[model samples]
Target: WLRGTRKDPPTLDETIAHENKRQQLEKKPINMLPTSYGRDAAQGGTGKCSA
Candidate 1:
């Protein structure tokens, strides 16, 4: 089923799971970048790599 088409609020577990999944997906690209920018600000340089 489509997530947005649901009528009822998600359960606590479902909500948390969805949040975790979203966070993971959001972080994956940064973590996958060929740099330590995800862990260190200094190493990230100008931080315009992704821009």
Candidate 2:
């Protein structure tokens, strides 16, 4: 019969699981860089600093 031959699509739970797995695999780490001014404020081996 048509009904028996047709396959059902993924359910809500299956969809959520697939999405979660995809997100986990596509995750990336953040890269940070300090500004030049920030580096200057650190002082060049002066050992004196102010916040």
Candidate 3:
């Protein structure tokens, strides 16, 4: 099962720190503006064209 290659899981402190960081992220607003990707004029990902 490749258990020897698997790294140890995060400790309690590590997991708490991770959760706190995630909570901080959840409090922030995500920039959903389409200034790239599915709205790039050059790339033509305006949702009308196929990938």
Of the candidates shown, which would achieve the greatest lDDT relative to the real structure?
1
What order do you get sorting by lDDT, best first? 1, 3, 2
**lDDT score for candidate 3 against the true structure:** 0.47
lDDT of each: 0.49, 0.42, 0.47
**What tens-digit string does per-residue lDDT give for candidate 2 at 1-51?**
013353886578766765565455345333424454345435531222111
In Å, residue 10's CA in model 2 sits off its true spot by: 0.4
* Prediction-by-prediction clash tally: 0, 0, 0
- After superposition on all C-alphas, the RMSD of every candidate to the true structure, in Å, is 11.2, 22.8, 13.1
List the pairs of residues colliding in candidate 2.
none
Q: Model 3: which ten-residue window has the lowest total lDDT?
A: 42-51
Q: lDDT by residue for model 3 over 9-34, one digit each (tens)?
A: 75787667655754564465567444
Give the TM-scores of the predictions, in the order they appear: 0.43, 0.41, 0.44
Instruction: For residue 28, give model 1's deviation from the true position in Å.
Output: 0.8
